[model samples]
Target: MITVVLPTRDSAARLVHVLPLLVPAAVDGLVKAVVFADAGSTDATLAIAEDSGARVVQAAGDAGARLSAGCAAARSAWILALGEDLVLPDAWRTPVEAHLAGGGGKPAFIAAPGPLGLAGRPLAVLASGEAVTAAGGFKAGGDPLKALLGRLRPRAVRLRI
Candidate 1:
């Protein structure tokens, strides 16, 4: 099972769009849990998260720190760290499952679909590691390419809508 971790601070509007996309994964048992490491929100972000069955943790710090905290709280062996504005593609389950089952220790980046049939930008990265060290070295301000290169095996997987 995998846990989807995201950091939110007054992200109610964004979650409205994102939560729906994640529900299917949860219902299908691919996503065991959703962790929202919130820094602080005056809005209904927490309310929405609870309503969606996500475990909300009190997180304090920058985006990277919040992400790390959320990841640390995850119960799954694999973790998918996603941006607030991103959404998983309809066909995400197959590829994700394949990657996990393939025993690829290297991290995989989910690509966002671009205009028309063009390539999209990398959105999220999935990895397997220790409770507090999953997706190693790819911190908020770290160099993604360098981190990927440092790994024993690196593979980039794109998720197109």
Candidate 2:
């Protein structure tokens, strides 16, 4: 079972779109139970989650904190911290399960809010049930054409299509 921990603040609308895509037990016994940790949302975020059978936790503070709280609520062995602003994919279930089950690696996937490098296979990096790119070493700084460089990690270079 893969516990997908989604962190949100005022994300009611987006959750509605993201929720339905995670069902039907696509990867054998791999159940995708959702945990929505709301950062003191005044909107209908919790309600949306409740209606969708998601476990909701009342949270406080930033994205990382909310994600941490949600991950703490997760019951699965592998925890996936996702953003509320994003819509997760349904097709990813099979690939992630297959990748993790390989047992040949300890995967950590970090994703930016953009396309990955051409040399990097998208599914291998994004759908490996690992952390996303941003969690790896990249940062998004408002420059649409480039990733902000992090000194302690991989150098960020502007990629051209």
Candidate 3:
């Protein structure tokens, strides 16, 4: 089982687009839970998250801090962190299950063709055990590369398209 963490600040519009895409994963049991680390959003983001059965964590800092808090609040051994605007492909479950079964320590990211077509890319990212530990140890806006390389050896897994 895996938990999905989404860090957001006034991202209701984006959530509307992304949350629905996540529901199927949750229903399929691939996602055990969804946590939204909110950074003082006065908009409908909180309401939307609540309505979707997502646990809300009060986060007050930069993106990295919010992400860390969310990951810390996760209950599953595997955690998937995602941007509010990203949407995973229909075939995402296969590679995620494969990674989990493979017992690889490297973090995996969905392959994107380019910057212009980010939405067309896969949305799932399987955060390894090392990556989760690194996230908790870093501060707000901390460099991700440092986390990936500092505590443990770095080897990134990319989900093929």
Q: Lowest-scoring 10 consecutive residues by lDDT in candidate 3?
A: 144-153
Per-residue CA lDDT of candidate 2, range 1-161, in tens? 67777777888778777666666652445656778878877799878877878898876866556665666677766655554454455465555555557634444333343545433321112222333323432222332111212231242222221
Give the alpha carbon lDDT tens digit for every residue of 1-161 in model 3. Answer: 88888878998877877777677878989889989989999999899988999999998887568877888899987777764444556567778778877856567766546667552343445775457686443356554323433443345567665
Native-vs-model 1 lDDT? 0.70
User: Can you write out model 1's per-residue Cα lDDT over 65-153, one digit (the tens) per residue?
Assistant: 67777888888987887764545566677777777787455567677667887756555667764522633643554533224424524
Each candidate's clash count: 0, 9, 0
Query: Against the unseen true structure, what C-alpha lDDT does each candidate score?
Result: 0.70, 0.53, 0.71
Residue 113, candidate 1: C-alpha displacement in angstroms:
3.4
Residue 116 alpha-carbon offset, candidate 1, angstroms: 10
* Per-model TM values vs. the true structure: 0.78, 0.64, 0.79
Look at candidate 1 and tell me the lDDT of residue 2: 85
In terms of lDDT, the poorest run of 10 residues in model 2 is 143-152
- Candidate 1 colliding pairs: none
Q: Which stretches of candidate 1 lie over 4 Å from their true place?
A: 114-120, 131-161
Candidate with maximal TM-score: 3
Candidate order by TM-score, decreasing, is: 3, 1, 2
